[model samples]
Structure formats: structure tokens, C-alpha cells
Target: MAFSAAESKLVSIFCQSVLYGVYVVLFTATTYTLLWGNKARRSVRRHNMLFVSFLIFVIATMHMATNFSRIVLAFIIHADAPGGPAAFFNELSNFTQMFGSTLYVFQTLLGDALVLYRSYLVWERKLWIVAFPCLLLLGSTATGIGILYAFDKVVPLADVFVVQLGHWITAFFSMTFTTNVICTSLVAYRIWTLNHRRKHGDSMRRHALRPALLLIVESGACYSATLLALLILYNVDSWFQYVVLDSVSPIVGIVFSVIMLRIASGVSTEEGETALLGESGVVNSGGGGVQLSVLDADPDQKTVAV
Candidate 1:
């Protein structure tokens, strides 16, 4: 069946509504991050997390706001009305619509950078292990910048350039997904390897690796799955691709904030610590750092540095 313009617009609106539902979670998560960061004591990691989370909060909000503006501009103005959807969007000169794309790209870059940084830390600060992801990040950033340049320079772009835009988007999403996968896998594997040395509260399960592993997988999977969907659909030439594109920024924001919130709350991991079970409220075997009473270490066993 042929796709009608009204049908397309309806799908786009539906996607935006779904994103708004997700945004509720985004706002909540961000508020929790802010509150938690405010209460956290001064430390290198604490200060860094606060700064990064705050920066992401600002960028994610901008991205969501831009999306809302474009959605209103696209849907509220009737196509038959003066300066309808076509005309408004046709003017690539109209900065608002395209601005969302840039904001989304910026947010994606920041998220990728954060994950890579965590990976670097988890791997005993071994820069070589994360070097590949870092390189991909740089390339992804350059590609994203190219897209921005394309939007600005090719206002009222030719029909032939649509495929060019698609290619750029595909590259961007693919790089991000790869980066996420590598970072998440490295972190999870490192934790899994350390699971054998587990020590925790039998009553509360406060120091178990299973829960920490689950949280990391679940949270990272939620974000990765969305991007993977978008990446797969990018080449399919479907209306749903447009819909997924519409919801991209909000979904990323929600996932990013949710992870931060969990960290801040000390639910999955502690602020300013490595993403390990010990970081998830375990009794630190190393007496030099935090000492939680919830779980006790075996006197006969050696303290393994995770």
C-alpha cells in the first residue's frame, strides 16, 4: 500500500507521544541524579560524575525541548494552512527542526564518551583496552559533525541527497552501538571474572555479583537495544524508521539518566567507584577504602583487587 502523508505524520506523532512517556522517567532520573550528587562528598570520582551528569542533564533537556518544538511545528500547523508542515520543513533554513538532530548527536557522543571512560577505569586504567572505542568515538563525532554541516550547507537539499543523509546516520548509530557493546562487554566480563571471589550479606544480598551483573546488563541493554533498532531500520526504508528517529533523543536521555540515578542511589553501584560488585555496597576487602558492615570477608581468603 502507498504511504499517505497523513499516515506518516500520525506515526511521527505517535512516536513523539511514546517519547513523552519516556521523558517522565528522564526527568525523574535526572532529578534523582541532581539530588544524589548534591549530597555526595568531595572526591575525584564524585566531582567528575556530578559534572558529567549535570552536563548530560543540560544536553538531554535541550534535545527533548528541540524535539517537542519540532513536533509541535510539524503537527500543530495544518498542512493546508499557511506555511504548513511541508513548507516549514522545506525551509532547511528553519533552524529548529535541524537543531534537534544536532542535540541528539551531542547527547549520543557524551553518552558514548562516558561509557568509554568507565571502561577505561574498570580495566585498571589500561588505555590500550579502550583505545579502539576511543578511536571509534572520535570518528563518530566527526561523522556527526559532518551531518550538522550537511544540514546547514545544504538547506533545501535535493532529493538525491536523502540517501546521503541516511548513510551518515547509519554510520553514526553503528559506531555508537559498537562502542556501547565493547565497553559493556569489557566491564561485565571483568566483573564476572571477579564473581568467584564474592563476599556479601546473606540476609540482604547486598554484596552479590548477580544483581550487579543484572543491573549492568539490563541498563546497558535497554539503551543499546534502542540504538540497534534504529541502526537496523536505517537501511529498511520504512516509515517506522522515521518514527524511531523521532523518539531517539528522548530514549537516550531516559536511559542515560536512569543509569546515573541508579548509580547515585547506590542501588546498582556507588558513586565515584568502579562498576564492580564491591562498588555495589560490598564489604571492601581492602580495609584502606570503604568498610561496610553488611558483608564480612573470610579471614582465610585473600583479598582480590577487582
Candidate 2:
């Protein structure tokens, strides 16, 4: 489908405006949830509070970078009247694009780290849990270097691959989605086997697996929506639809914050102790009174909710 010059200009303006609006909303929600949310301060939750906080900051940065990029593009398009201001804006846009690309690499790796951490918790493995984050760091650094090199060497290829194909690939094959499914499947298999063994009896193991189950399902749903959007609408000029997808991260962030807050606020005694150790994390009190903790917590640690 081809767009007339006027139509293309209108679409661009609409996209830029929507991006700016979502940018404001996302930054506000992220700041409030991290800084002043009651659940955010709890000491007993199992999720990595520091990592979550860091993720929030990264999301904010992403939004800000996008917003600045949009503003620069808008200025360049409408800069019929020339001045030093237009030249400065052009330079600023170039810088933001570089920074934004770097941050996107970090975001991808961070998602992978979270997935690995969650998987380790399910398997009750100490080694995998420790190794995954280190692996992610190395992977991120290498990917960042590769992206920089590609960006510098092949302009057309980088624009198509990095700018367009990157989002398309990630929307479907993101580390978060892949890991969540794998971990959840493993957990489900275990739950099924436990249930089979207890065909004529009751098992507490089923209860212990509930939180992981819920998290897996939720992550799957969010990723599914994102994937659908990418598949069906990403290349289309449906500003409204793209905005919906763009807004997904912040909305997911808020939902996660709320659920986490609830869990943090109601940690059990054993779980609280576990939280302090920094090994196994605690989900809030619920589901047949099962208290789950990991074994890899550092003995010197305190303040476990994340």
C-alpha cells in the first residue's frame, strides 16, 4: 500500500504525538511504583527488587529515548525555516538513536536474565541461577558490540535489520517468552507427575508450584499479545494499534508491581527469613498455606523482596 505525501505526514505526526503521550504515562507510572509504592518497599518478596527497580529505570530510559527521537524527527521534517536550532536538533537526534540502540540491547539481555533466574528457582538449582546472569552480561556485551559494528558498516542493512527486523524477531522469539514457556512446562510436568503419584492421595507439591504456574501463565499471555501485534500490525501505519503495543511494557510493569506488592505485603515468617538470606524468595501467603523458599540465598544478605 502506498501513502500520499500528505497521508504519510499525517501518520508520522500522529505516531509522534502518541509516543510522547505514552512516554509521559509510562515514566509517571514507573516512578511512582518504584519510589512510593508500599509493596515496593517490602523485605520479604521473592522477586529481585533491585533488578525490578533497574528494569523500571531502563523502561523509563527507553521511553525517553523514543520521545526524543520522535521530537527530532518532527523537527527535521518541519524545519523549512533554517536556523542553528535545527542543526542542533539534528545532532541531538543522532546521539539519542545511538543511546537508544545500546539500551535496547541491555533490555533484551535483562529479560533473559529474569527468565533464567525464574527457571533456576523452579528447578531448585544453585549453579544455573548463578551462571545465567553472568552469561547474560557477556551475551549483552557481545551483542552490543556487534550491533555497533553493523550500524557503522552497513547503513541499509542496519536500518532494515536492526531497526525493522530486530523488533520483529524479538516480538516472537524474546528470551522472556522462551524461558517462561520452558520453565512453566517443566513445572507443569513435575506437577503432573506428582499428581499421578498421588492418584489415591494428596500432595503438598502441587500447592508449592502454584506461584510459578501463575507467573508462567501471565508472562505467556503478555508475550502472546505482543507477538500478535508484531505479526499483524507492526508494518502497518495503524498508529492506534502500535501505540497499544508500545504501551504494553508499562502496563505489564504496573500489573507486575501490583501483584508483587500484594505478595510482598503478606510474606510468611519462614518466607521472611528466607527472604533475608537471599536464597529462595517468598510468594505471599495463599494457596493451601504452602511456604516456598530457595536454597541459594546468601547468608549475609538482608532485605529480600524484589
Candidate 3:
């Protein structure tokens, strides 16, 4: 079935709206965890995470708002204009559309950078480990900007599957996909290696690391899968790409916040209070990185201090 641009836009808006609502609830819970959920003392790391959370939430909000505006312009404001909503949405150069695209670019790059940083942290701050992923991120940023510029210069009302924009967009998508896969793999490997090294420990301690690794892999997979779908649909010139594209921002925010809340949940005290406390000073507490806190293991307790 060949779906029209307007149909894609309608589906995109609907999916994005639902995702945005979910993101709002997750963001609220994440905010509470970072702010007051910690029964123990708060550190600069928590504050930093809170700040980044707020920033990402704001960006997602703006993306959603711009999308809503675009919807209005396409469906209601210009319903009877020529080709109707399809033609209106095809105007990628329009300011509102451009702005939303820009936000998606920014949100994606920010998430990639955070993943790279997390990789660096989990690898014990080994600068050499993240060196290549950094380069990939640079490539992603360049191609991302390139695509945006190309969008403005492309023939008015032309779809994004055209030659001028295709190359840049493909490069952007591929680079981002590669960057995320590499960084996420690195983080997951590091966690596994650390756990493997502690194989002689008690079962509780041995199983503690699994949750962290699982959380990282599961969360990373969500974003990677989305990107892969986008890359495939884009190359095939499917109108369904718009649905994936519009949902990207909220998905990014949701994934990021989910990690925060999950980790906080893991390290929560036994009294059913959620907290993220590091036994040895501050661990990998950077914003958006897997905040790994090594709590002192107790022989009698089956606590998850990953």
C-alpha cells in the first residue's frame, strides 16, 4: 500500500502525541527520583543528571509543540489549499518544519554524546576507548547539519527522498547508528567483563551486575532499533519514515529517563526507598551515563547494588 504524505503525517502526529504523554509521566518520575527519591545524601552528580533531564524534557516539549503547529498548518489552516495537507507537509523548507527537524537533530546528537560519555566512564575513563566513537559522532554531527542545510536548499515541496538530501541523510543515519552501537556495546562489554572478573563472589553479588547490563542493553536496543528502522524505511522511500522520524525525540527522552529511574530503583535502600548512593565516593555519575554505584555487599542481604 502506498501511503500518502498526509496519512504518514497524521499517523506520525498521533504516535508522537502518545509517546510524548508517556515521556511526560516518565520525566516526572525521573525528576522525583533525582530530586527527592534519594533518602541518602545528594551529590553533584544527581544535580547534573537533573539538569540534563530538564534540558532534554524541554527539547522534547518544543519538538512536540512544533509538530503540533505543523499539524495545524497542514490539516486545518491549509486543508483546502491545492493538494491539501500532503502538499503542505511536503514543504520541508517551511520554518516550523525546519525548526522541528533541527530539534530532532539536536536531541539525537545530545543522546549520542551522552552514550559516548557513558562508554568512556564504564571503560574506566579510558580516553582511547571512546576515540573512534567520538569520530563517528563528529561524522554524524556534520552530516546532520549537512542534511538540514540541504533541506532548505532542495526544490520547494520536494520530498526528502530526493538525491540532494538522500546522501546526507543516509550518512547521518548510518553514522548515528554506528556510533550508538559501538558505544552501547562498549558499555555492555565493560559491565560483563567486570562481573566476570568477580565470578568468585556470592550469588547475590554475582547477579547484581546483570541488571545493569540488562538495563543498558535493553535501553540502548530501543534507540538502535528505531534508528535501524528509520534507516531502512528511509532508503526504501517509505512514507512510514515520517512516523519514525516524528517519534524519535520522545523516544530518546524516554529511554534516557528510564535508565535513570531503573538504576535508582536498583540501588534503593531496603526500606523501599529509591536512592543512588556510591560506596566509594562518586562513581560514574555523569549525566546520562549508567550511574554505577558499588554499594558495600552484605552477606545476609540479597540487595541489588549494581
Query: lDDT per residue, candidate 3, 1-306, as tens digits?
Result: 887888898899999999999999999988887777653125446766788889999999999999989889989999999989888888879999789889999999999988887777666688999999999999999998998899899998898898999999999999999998888777766654553343225543555655554545433668888998999999999999999999999999998887666554444221112222223322222233334444333344333333
* Model 2 lDDT tens row, 189-266: 433342233221222233445434443432334543553554344345433333444344444444344334433433
- Pairs of residues clashing in candidate 3: none
User: What is residue 115's positional error in candidate 2, in angstroms?
Assistant: 2.5
Tens-place lDDT per residue, model 1, 1-306, is: 844333554676567667756766666665655555543442345656667666765666676566567667666864566656645554554688568777778888887887787677657788999999999999899899877776676637332137547677678889999998888777766644533344333521545655465546533656667778878866665545656666766666666666656555443343223333333234432334543222223334344332
TM-scores, all models, native as reference: 0.74, 0.50, 0.83
Lowest lDDT sum, 10 consecutive residues, model 3, at 269-278
Instruction: Give the CA lDDT, 0 to 100, for residue 167 in model 2.
Output: 48
Steric clash pairs (candidate 1): none
Candidate 1 local Cα displacement, residue 38, angstroms:
9.9
Range of the 10 consecutive residues with the lowest summed lDDT in candidate 1: 271-280
**Best by TM-score, which number?**
3
Q: In lDDT terms, which candidate is top?
A: 3
Candidates in order have lDDT scores of: 0.61, 0.43, 0.76
Candidate 2 ranges with C-alpha deviation above 4 Å: 1-51, 75-93, 126-141, 156-158, 162-177, 184-220, 224-252, 267-306
